[model samples]
Target: MAFHYPNGTPYNNHEAPKSKKQVKKQKSIQFGKRGMDFEEEINKSNAYYLSRNTAVIHKKPTPVQIVKVDYPSRSAAVIKEAYFRQASTTDYNGVYNGFYLDFEAKETKNKTSFPFKNFHQHQIDHIRQCLAQKGICFVLLWFSSLNRCFFFSGEALVTYWAEQETTGKKSLPLAIIEKNGIEIQIGIAPRIPYLDAVEQYIQSKKGVAMNDN
Candidate 1:
């Protein structure tokens, strides 16, 4: 089955094919040996949390409108084409420790910076709305090359996102993220142990300095 965007264009999870230079750059980056992709790691972590009654989190499912279906067999129906009902707002959202949690997960092979292109305007707007409601908002940024990840708050993201025009900076430097974001250590059962960062974030909001690590 082929999925399409609402604009009538084919829906592709990956960007267009990389150029020779891009491929060379990718080949040079040493990604973490961790068995799963960033998003998958997060999903497994969520499941772990759910099983332990630690927090309730899940990835928001993309709404698709099935266009054509064919019964290849009497018991099997195969969708031939579909279209997204609407663009996604953000990657994941849920309730954790009695506070609403919403975030996007992004990964980069670049060793020094994270490009602003990973975000879309709609996602920014959605985050802004969540902020208006005082909901907990942040992003999980995975630096594949360094095997590092950080919890970057939504407020900080908005601040840097706006500086694009004023400061002429297109990407968020790793130094800035390191300074402001909470670093999460990779683990086995919960591959991405992010709730620790979330707890720290909650503490910061209350003006209470505490580190559970």
Candidate 2:
């Protein structure tokens, strides 16, 4: 069953993007492939990977600066005052196959384009910096309405984000993503299975060399 917000917008803690107001709409999906929310799936997939020692990717802790703390009865400490320290680099980062992997996960219900508003300027700059250090950077884009997921490289996202003013493209079209990104299949055990998509992407970039004699 799909989880819906108070206003009737379907959102699951697992796959739903962190947005204040969700688009009040629903998209239909056929049988057999239906499953839980996107974020939930990704979290489960990460757990699967961690259990198998396949990767060490973890969601970055929220940056918070504790200003005041109250110790009540020597058993509980209550946070009286706190503030966000700063914007974080990305959602997830870790070491996989000797390569540093960093990425952000996001979801959108827009059927036309993936909005740039979903990403912060700081994140774009961070991806660029990670690319400079040879890190495997990407974004897990979940199209909730279409029930599709894409692993798009940071280079593509950065290039397009930079050209927004020149091209006047406020969002990335599905066509562009189809050409450049790798589509991932959602499954039960792991959910998002984005790492599988990442492996495919890495192999595609490596060409036939890894397969040849």
Candidate 3:
């Protein structure tokens, strides 16, 4: 069988099908070999949530400065040059269950720890501000090498981030994260059922506050 693009171009299918061993080898090297990046998975999960009327979340678009454009035809124009004007604050944000949900999705290849360098100071500051406003802010971290994911609180992450300068610690240890963060189980429908973790986190915070009182 042959596949063709919508434009009537025949899709190339000359390569031989991969064997089981070959597929396994690739998966070992590339985590799941699911063909979609971590961010894409999160986007699909968000779409799924939206479709079910569960939550409304969306990825923030990066601001780019267009420098040049080429109009090859009357109906189409091509962007010839563009540059990013500034750094983005976070990846995803929206209102979920009357709470302002904001978060950044990130993946790491490291098996032992997630490096602090993966995050920027501006992002930390932005999340901190949101947290101060009592917004539900956190990060979805995918530990690719271990095929594990966790929902880390923005408050805890920022607190560790501040310690990085004085303590000289470079990374967040996996053990520490496993203990403090909420582990998210991978699933088919939602992909990463992070909202479940969010709910759990909210309950835990409430419990702690009540204990303090």
- Which candidate number maximizes lDDT? 3
C-alpha TM-scores of all predictions: 0.78, 0.79, 0.81
Model 3, span 24-130: residue lDDT tens:
34222233344445765788788889889999998766556999999999899988998655554776899888989999887778889988877888789899999
- lDDT tens readout by residue for model 2, 1-213: 344445665532234443322222211222223444555466667878888899987776656689999998688989999875556598788988898999988777777678887788889999999999989899988887788889999989999998995887778998989899999887776777788878987887678556674
lDDT computed for candidate 2: 0.76
Off by over 4 Å in 3: 1-36, 71-75
Clashing pairs in 1: none
User: Candidate 1 lDDT, tens digit per residue, 1-213?
Assistant: 222225554522223333335333432222245534576578878988988999988876655699999998999998899865545578688898799999998877778998887778888899999999999999999988788999999999998998985987879999999999999999897889999999999889877433433
lDDT of 1 at 91: 68
Worst 10 residues of 2 by lDDT: 23-32
Number of clashing pairs per prediction, in order? 0, 5, 0
The per-residue C-alpha lDDT of model 3 at residue 85 equals: 52
Which pairs in model 2 have colliding backbones? 14-39, 14-40, 15-38, 15-39, 15-40
Better of 1 and 3 by lDDT: 3
TM-score of 1: 0.78
